[model samples]
Target: MGIEAELITAADLPRLEQFDGLLIRDHTRIDNYTFAFAQRAAELGIALVDDPVSMQGCSSKLRQAKLFEAHGVPTPKTLVLTRETLPIVPALLGLPCVIKEPESSFSRGVHCVASEAELVELVTALLAHTPALIAQEFLPTGFDWRIGLVDRQAIFACRYHMVPGHWQVVRDAGTPEYCEGRTEAVALGDVPAAVLASARLAGDAIGDGFYGVDVKDLDERCVVIEVNDNPNVDAGHEDGVAGPELYEAVIGTIARRAFGAGR
Candidate 1:
């Protein structure tokens, strides 16, 4: 894969015409510059890792939750909470539920509320930024399964364990010191059949593109947590065990798309 890749900024939007294909690794939002670049790439007929369709699907939690239910992907009980509907969350989903802003990523704007008082306060504060929030039943799993998918195929798997005395994998408990749990890469064949099946379903529901499907395994049942578009594929963390193969697969896909090798 002899693709010449370059790091670009918003100032280089006009220069994208020189590239055959674009790999969007930046954070995406509906009104952000990432989406602007995606729109421009589509207009230029350049292949993109996450097309605009998948970006819209992955950015909003409310949209993803509905897609999960409609597509029969198992997920924790979820509800859309606004200022008016926030009071009924504790009753509908019960105490110890998780609240999330629609566009939050990397555990930011996500909160685990254990009481009614906390729920009210957190929802009020979160609503200042977003119009609605997603409230889900607290599925207390010590770890979460991250299935990396490339073009609807399982490329990598890992168990993201939670920090000690924390409820989520990435702990943001009022301090700058964040705790990152251990990442153990597991072979795709070694993963449970149910989890793989669920991950496949989640990947298909989003679109046939590069994705990281987060799932929770409870009592042998696999529940989809969320689908991520720009998933982590760091040098050592995500690619620890199968670093070479994983990198090759990803770059191969990019190369094929850019140069039309397989087509």
Candidate 2:
């Protein structure tokens, strides 16, 4: 895999013409430069790990809720949050529900509200800057199953354990007190069939590109958490069990898409 690659930043937009493909390794948001890069790559007919469509879809939890419902993908109870919907939240998702900003990344803008007071406080704070938010049923789980997929196939799997005494993966993310949980990559052969099936369905609902579908294994049943584009592939975490093959699978897909082998 002697693929010549170089690091780039937002300032290097003019130099994009020199590359056959692009792999975005940064947190993507609808209003960010990453999305612009994806759009530029698409305009240039370049192979990109996550096409602009995928980035846009994955950036909005509201859109994802509708997408999952339309595709019949299993997910926790989720609803769009607005000032009008505030009073009905408790009735819809109950207390201890989860609230998320549409463009949240790295678990920064996600919060678990255990009481009505907390729900209102958090939702009000979030909605002050954004037009809407997403409220989801609280599904308490010790860990979440992350299924990495490329071209609608599972390449690697890992269990992201929750931080102790916390309900989400990362506590105080984007702050000085930020801390995260443990990650244990698992062999694809050992992953539960239901988890894999749900992840594949979630990925299919999004697009046939790179994705990391997060799932919760509750009582042997699988519930999709979210579909993440431009998912992580850290050396000792996502690539732990799969080893070099993980890199090969991802790079090969990009190469094929770049050279018109499977575009």
**lDDT leader:** 2
Determine which window of 10 residues in candidate 1 has minimal summed lDDT: 254-263
lDDT of 2 by residue, 7-124 (tens): 9999999889899999898878888898899999999999898888898779888888889999999998888999989999999998889898987778977888899998888888
Cα lDDT of all candidates, in order?
A: 0.86, 0.90
Candidate 1, residue 144: how far the Cα is off, in Å: 0.5
- List runs of model 1 lying over 4 Å from the truth: 173-175, 261-263
Off by over 4 Å in 2: none
How well is each residue in 1-263 modelled by candidate 1, as lDDT tens digits? Answer: 57777888889898888888788888877878988898888888887787888889999999998888889998888898998898788888999999988988889878888999999988888888889999999998888999999888888999989888888888874578988877878877788888899999998999977899998989767899999997988777778777798877777777787768773
lDDT for residue 222 in candidate 1, whole number 0-100: 80
